[model samples]
Target: MMGEDADMRTMLAPPMSTPHDAGRRDLEQRYQRVCDLFPDQRVEIVNGRIVIREVPTLDHNRMIFRLLLQIMAFADQRGWTACNDIKLFLGTQVDRYRPDITVVPAEPRMWDAENVYADQTLLVVEVVSPSSRDDDNLLKPHSCSLAGVPLYLVIDPLEKTARLLSQPGRSGYVQQDAVMLGELLLLPDPWDLKLDTGKFLN
Candidate 1:
């Protein structure tokens, strides 16, 4: 039995590092350097490209703050944390995201280092800006759905609407609900909360 265990351990040991491994590590270090150089902007890897997002406008910040205030109390009651601009690891192929707002379990077990797995998040909210309209409206929903995120909310100031996507699956969200700004948005099961969007119109 001891001999068998030793053999198994040897088999499971990490393989010898290759040139590819060194290259990957060097890329990671370079990415970290870029992030350090631009601490004020959002730097991400998307589709194997390094993208830097400019800081948001005041109106955008205010809108997120309004939504955050509403979600904070509810999340607190449910042992979830509501945060803005946190790193979210989307998938294995060099994709990272910083959702405008994210609701996640407060427990450390749900987190992965400094990044949160999309499948473990309770909700992800994206407030659209001119530069990110396509990504926020189309690409994000698809990625989040594939990652099994339960809920995704899109607030579009340009459209003056809010959309809630639910029932994530291999294909995408099976259900979607939308309302104009200033209307009440219903968050379904597991949330069962009503969001008052009256103040969002400012």
Candidate 2:
């Protein structure tokens, strides 16, 4: 038999959470530990804390569906792939963020084997909720900018508006356009995609 330390190492080798390590693990360890625990749930690591929110509302999922269709079509045209509900890890420099949708390269990388890295992230779309307003707006823009994510689109159905930010830099995106419902947002090249908001208005 191995020593107690070696036994502990072998026990926690896989990412299945146990009752013992529930309360005192660090942020990074906690994040990895919950990977498979909530396989069918929406779990996120926010500000060094693990958060589990209620299942998204129908309207939320509907908005996500509409935007996802657009992104998928756009990516298909460019021969790229769009994944929904993927966690975009920005390394230790920035915390993790689970966007409603993320557009990435066709090929996978080591970093993306589990969580998709921000460097591989081309575009991210977030459908805002009342509970997540600050996160979807303030926190995400700051982190995505710091991580060099090219485009960050925030859609707020409650506000009947959308905010598009680009040109990520240390301070944040240099350009920002606040688009009202029904107004078209033409994403910059190389995607050059146009987002329609008519349905979101009605």
Candidate 3:
């Protein structure tokens, strides 16, 4: 997606808001201050707290790379865009989240090199690490849904499972599919990319 196209679509998307909780606000402020100090660090505000996990394992990194390669190739063929480890600002309280993978349709804002917002994202993918499984599997999905991201993909190597979530409701996805190895998962709207679960496990 191009930057200009994304900007136009963002105008139609819901506006970002701050979390209602006081604790969330306090943590958001702290996170912003820290981000200012260390712009290289990947951080996020989850469950009203500022949490930072280490870079993923070698296997995890390989998996992400492979996924991105595949997704990017396919997206390019279809004139779409795929980004990896990009910070998505969902709201004031939830400023920066580094999803392992994100896909957006061709739009100018999507091409913007400066800022990457959640509203620009059509799909958010979380490849679970041992240290980040809980947050990725539960909290992040709910947060992305609340932000109105269309699709959420949870890839868990530990369990060798891939779950596709869509139809976002107030809390999270109203529809979800747990796809095991050898099964294909379908994404919702915008792109509706189909992913083979078996390829994700290795």
Candidate 4:
């Protein structure tokens, strides 16, 4: 399915509740307060609660930087808009997340200081780590789908595979394509770009 179709499906889907709904408000308030004090930490809210990830390992950092550089290069060449590690607010119930990489069509609003919400994000990429596999593959994609983010990419270094998720239906990605090393995956428009799996694993 195309990105536009996935977006429409996401818009029509109903909301899903997280496990920690009871103290959600309190947790959100505390997280906000902490964020006010430290804007550089890049904290996120997941499953109706706050989650702070530690500094990644050297290998993790290397992979993230490689992906970022590639995306940035693509953006530069194609005149697209790509952001690295930007916080995205995905749900009405205070679920915020920071995708490792996000790609959006070039828009003036993206540069505006007042526009904090990016409802037009075309693609979101997450680099999986031992501590975040569940969240990356399940919770994060579910939330993104509900919020109408068109495409979700999960790069699993452990498995040395990339899962491309499209057709975001009521329960997250309705269509999943697993691309192993030596294969290439093509993204939908406005990207319409091809990614080599070997480059990702290395």
Q: Between candidates 1 and 3, which one is better according to TM-score?
A: 1
Residue-wise lDDT of candidate 1 within 1-202, one digit each (tens)?
A: 9999999999999999888678667766777788899987888765445678878889989999999888888889988888786887776544677888888887633346668888888889998999889888988788889888899999999999999999999898999999999999998877888998776778
| Residue ranges of candidate 3 with Cα displaced over 4 Å | 1-26, 36-38, 108-115
- Model 2 over residues 1-202: C-alpha lDDT tens digits? 4698898998879887665445435666776778668877777877667776567888888888878767777688766777777788777545777788888888745365658778677789888888888888898788889887889999998889999999999998999988897889988977777888766653
lDDT of 2 at 132: 86
Give the true-structure RMSD of model 1.
Answer: 3.8
Candidate 4 on 131-167: residue-level lDDT in tens?
8899998898887777767789998999888888887
Clashing pairs in 2: none
State how far residue 202 of model 3 sits from its true place (Å): 3.0
Candidate that would win on lDDT:
1
Instruction: By lDDT, rank the candidates, best first.
Output: 1, 2, 3, 4
**TM agreement with the true structure for every prediction:** 0.83, 0.82, 0.77, 0.77
Summarize candidate 3's per-residue lDDT along 113-145 as a digit string, tens digits: 634666667788888888889999988888888
Better of 3 and 4 by lDDT: 3
TM-score of 2: 0.82
Clashing pairs in 1: none
Clashing residue pairs, backbone N/CA/C < 3 A, model 4: none
How many backbone clashes can be found in candidate 2? 0
Ranking by TM-score: 1, 2, 4, 3
Deviation in Å, model 3, residue 164 alpha carbon: 0.5
